[model samples]
Target: MPELGLDTLKAALPEYAKDTKLNLGSVLGNGQLPEQQLWGTALACAIAAGNATVTAELAAEATDRLKPEVVRAAKAAASIMAMNNVYYRAKHLIGDPEYQSLPAGLRMTVIGRPGVDKVDFELWCLAVSAVNGCGTCLESHEKTLREAGVPRGTVHDALRIAAVVTAAATTLSAEQALG
Candidate 1:
């Protein structure tokens, strides 16, 4: 229940000063232009992590390097998105009379093998949902994780990674054009 102090930091940071400002990339892009958005979301996640220098450094690197970092970060974010999508579908299925009646062992083979600890996965889901602007995903993950006893810090940390990765993505394009 401890505060992460993000509100205070947000209030102090300027609009562009914080590399984690990625509403444009996550909400507007809808993850269509990944190469571009990777950098933006990475920065946003990094800022959420409270590591401005490292995120900025990734941005400063040459396009070749910067692009890779963006890819890695964005890929991580996207992977979580896909995972959540699958998990939610499976969850819905479990609510059905047929799936609900199935044994746990069978369920594991069909849906649980790829699943992770709901707490851990939900934390990542929250981050990607925020960056990807999936309100339903965000709300569900947020609600579930809170109920699962995940500390707020854990959620904040995951979001920080998403923000940092998004910001780092932008440097790639800038560097590529110049390089």
Candidate 2:
């Protein structure tokens, strides 16, 4: 396969998703985040978006910009958040006080030892949570980021990247299904 990147993703989008293609380009390179945070958030959101093409292309671009450990931490955040978002979102939506008191019983040691900056990991998790629509997770991650002195603009940029990546993935899936 030809090397896939943002250009590939943009080209794959149907005309109806033209805005998504434009947004993808803008968010990837014009965000407030620093290089590591930008690429890490993109990679994590791409994984959470669950598009192999998006994930692969973002991973390739991220590898060129981020350290190996940071890349791993980004992937770990996506993986852990995938499970945590579902469990926590369901518990929050169920509105059962009993569920809140119960032990999660899930192994999530990576959250404690992500081998990257804690705030960066939290930001990536926040981005993934946004993609997953897990309000509880989003709130928790946002609070952690805020307490760590991360700027709201940085957080907003991360969410924008997440939104664009998820939208791109969804559009790609729709295009495939309609073909």
Candidate 3:
């Protein structure tokens, strides 16, 4: 059986990345997140939160037409970030490459996403990074968004959303506490 590819996605998206030169998740995840950023973020969050069951289930639920770019991005981000963690851990424990900043640029912003208002994406990525405890990734995402003129308030708002979602598990506790 042939696997999924960009041309086989559920939806039609801009053929090219708008401002950004990459849609890393698309390439790495083999063209998963076609153009659905929201979907991709959710899936990515599930993966980052260490819920493999949910991640797999969600990915499976993504049908040919409803498949979102977010889901694919999440998978790709999780996969690459996991590899990155291993490299850093090994280096910290033994010997890391001197120029550690030299990643394969796997997480570079997605193509066709450059023109989309990216404040939300930045925030979402930040949340995922926080959950994964990836300072470098967090910094990179934040810096790029800020440089692109994402206002401070906008960035803060995005982070706030991330915070809320990141603490989604605490909702029950919060509700009980209020009661």
Candidate 4:
């Protein structure tokens, strides 16, 4: 197989997905975040978007730009948030006070000891949560980030990356399915 990256993905997009291609370029070029946070958010959101091609490309790019531990943490954020988003979203939507009192019982030790910085991991999780549409998780992560002194603009940039990555993945998947 040929190498897949952002350029390859962009080129593969159909005419109707032009907005996604443009947004992908703009969001990835955002300067509000440090390299680690920006790329980590991109990689985590790619995994959360559930496209093998996008994930592979972003993972390769992230590996080239981020340290090994940072890459691992980004993946962990994606994996853990996948479960958390579903569970927490359901719990919040159910509106059962009992569920709130009960323990999550999930093994999420990674959130505490993610090899990367806590705030960066939280940001990545926030990005994934945004893609997953878990408002509870988004609010929780955003609050944590804000408390940690992360600027709103930085958080917004991460969400923008997540939004564009998810859109690109969905567009690609739709095109592949229709073809």
Better lDDT candidate (1, 2): 2
> Candidate 4 deviates by what RMSD?
1.8
Identify the candidate with maximal lDDT: 2
Clash number for model 2? 0
Q: Mark the regions of model 4 whose C-alpha exceeds 4 Å error after superposition.
A: 1-4
Candidate 3 regions exceeding 4 Å error are: 1-37, 52-67, 85-125, 157-179
lDDT of candidate 4 over 26-141, digit per residue (tens): 77854468899998999999999998878888888889899998998999999999999999999999998899988999999999999889999999999999999999999999
Model 1 TM-score relative to the real fold: 0.41
What is the RMSD of candidate 2?
A: 1.7
TM-score of each: 0.41, 0.95, 0.45, 0.95
Collision pairs in model 4: none
